[model samples]
Target chain A: MTGFGHNSEDEAEGRIEALAEMMARLPGLGPRSARRAVLHMLQRRDLLMTPLADAMHDVAAAARECVQCGNLSTAETCAICREERRANGEICVVEDVASLWAMERAGAFRGRYHVLGGLLSALDNVGPDDLRIPRLRGRIADEGVREVILALPATVDGQTTAHYVADAVEGSATVSTLAQGVPVGGELDYLDDGTIGAALRARRSL
Target chain B: MTGFGHNSEDEAEGRIEALAEMMARLPGLGPRSARRAVLHMLQRRDLLMTPLADAMHDVAAAARECVQCGNLSTAETCAICREERRANGEICVVEDVASLWAMERAGAFRGRYHVLGGLLSALDNVGPDDLRIPRLRGRIADEGVREVILALPATVDGQTTAHYVADAVEGSATVSTLAQGVPVGGELDYLDDGTIGAALRARRSL
Candidate 1:
């Protein structure tokens, strides 16, 4: 298998190239960077590459969606969804688990979350039923949810999903959207016109 | 584990965080991008994450350094070193396997390679015996090598290593270094002083 210069060499190279190609599919990595990453991993197999492979395999085997909120979890329900105190009659709805994680990272939302998995997109033919809207309405009544805060993006599809969710849970809970305006530490010059206008319109008396 | 939010929940989160931390150790990924990549992978476990994990495991299990040249291979010797036709009395000496790969990608060199693993560095206290210089000397005599082209970088350490290698293989084979100047498509304005000087000194007549 070694010094004979047969097709086994191509097979070995193929394994490495296949790994690089798979790595390139990740969010921030491209073909060249993926190759470099693969090479770096190969150079530090004991220290980095083997450990990375184990971690990925562990996550792949364990990770699942929270049955209640659609968040990534190892169990049927996620940590936040299972916490008794988190059921504070408020459910913050987000377009995906990433946004849900962002809210958790901020540590501002003590209430539970409801991950929609995606927004309603007319362009992509995504409808209300396509998301977790039906499940959200079920949670509002079953969990005694009083407020459903939409922590969705400011995109058209996001707003459309929010509106649809609001309508779906019309009589059950109070529906609200995340504040739209200039961000914290944001410069006025760098802000777009829509943001500036929203900031001006939603001005506080302070 | 499904509904009880005890230590198991934290353990679940730990698995994900651990995966993200490992991903962050990659060349181009940071903490945030690593988290995002993890989330993306979790979402498409069967489609992307599982395949990635399998590929990484395969590479980790099979990948090994070639005994002859230090290039990556599954066998004792690399494909180039094993190919009889590639033993054309020319050995392209490189600093690492990555440089060897870059040269392979260019497909301009038709001979075997000798990977030095690293260059001579005074600051790091790396000396001749620290690299593959002695092994290279052995190859030059044993393999009937005629030319040893140093395709190392233009860094100070790279040049230092090249000079050391040239002296080491002085009487055994013809030694040469890669030409320095403005890159093929590069403008003179972007080239450094040393490169311009080298280009002027090594100017060839039509």
Candidate 2:
């Protein structure tokens, strides 16, 4: 008998294979794990599977990066930017949208964010305009932003980008960064909320 | 100022919350990890998010449990049952649909399956009827089945149910159970294909 009792050329087979391919591309998932995950999702479709799919569809159709801050949102301006109360003369700069969300999850930073999209990488030929650094400079001057908090990684590339941004906005705004003891090679995404809060509370001058 | 610059109760907030809630219900996921997962999905919407959501939607709409064997399928009868060659007079019985799929992953067991749904459990008040025992009995008589291979867990309830099934089907057909070496408290879902195959090959009389 055929394995799985289904011809690979059949319609159902094609759909399953497609799903497996997509799942395999996700971080930490390989072909074998993807197959298991697909089967699991199929069995739990009524509860976990269906809702996950619907959420994905809704987000796919509506999601866009905030033009000003690079945070994922459905609008040109992210919700924080649109809120008048959030215009508190401060901006927390991060390397990615994931980091920005991490800060939000900690519930410690009440200031707005400026997503750099990525850190400067000479090996990858990335430069200032490659990120939103120019936009950040304009925001500091125009929006009366007083304090700039850098939450970039401790990696060489991240530090380079941090120093570059600090220099660019040096005279116009005060610059600081989250303190060390946040762990080496750890992303803000994996930090405990309290740890993040501590790092934010102990931020140091650049 | 709010981080990421969005109004607290905006459409984006609603969508993100919905996604996080659904993710939290997934196996091995909690509320905090679910939030992180949703944020990751949002950041990679173009590459990983959109396709995964589409696959989830398609499977949610089309997937259904095989009425005959309890395996997930897109039709009334699963592909395994519909295959003429797979109806080889031998039925590998399993406690749940997951074990059956695990067997299929091994590309062995060239026969049909009868998913028991769950094992008999007196403590929880589950009995033979709570499983697919009646349907299995009917299949033995109707399909000219020659063997019934039990691949249930090694739990107290699982073994008790196996014996009960063996006694019930003794006169009607040959009954067998997978051999030991399966870890205690381990579900067939977690066994490697090799272990499952070895267990199947070394099966003994019930």
Top TM-score prediction, candidate number: 1
TM-scores computed on chain B for all candidates: 0.90, 0.78
Model 1 per-residue lDDT tens digits across residues B169-195:
999999988887667898888888888
For model 2, residues A53-140, the per-residue Cα lDDT tens digits are 8887787666677777888776667788888898999999999877887798889999899999999999999988798998998899
Recovered native contacts in candidate 2, as a fraction?
Answer: 0.32
Candidate 1 residue pairs in backbone clash:
none
List TM-score per model, in order. 0.91, 0.78
Q: lDDT by residue for model 1 over A1-206, one digit each (tens)?
A: 35444334446567788888889999999988898999999878899988888888888887777888988887667888878999999999998888988898899999999999898888898877788888888898899999989898998888888888888999999988889999999999999999999999999997
Count of backbone collisions within predicted model 1: 0
Residue A173, model 1, lDDT: 91
10 residues in a row with least lDDT, candidate 1 chain A: A1-10
For each candidate, report its DockQ versus the true two-chain complex: 0.50, 0.26
lDDT of each: 0.86, 0.79
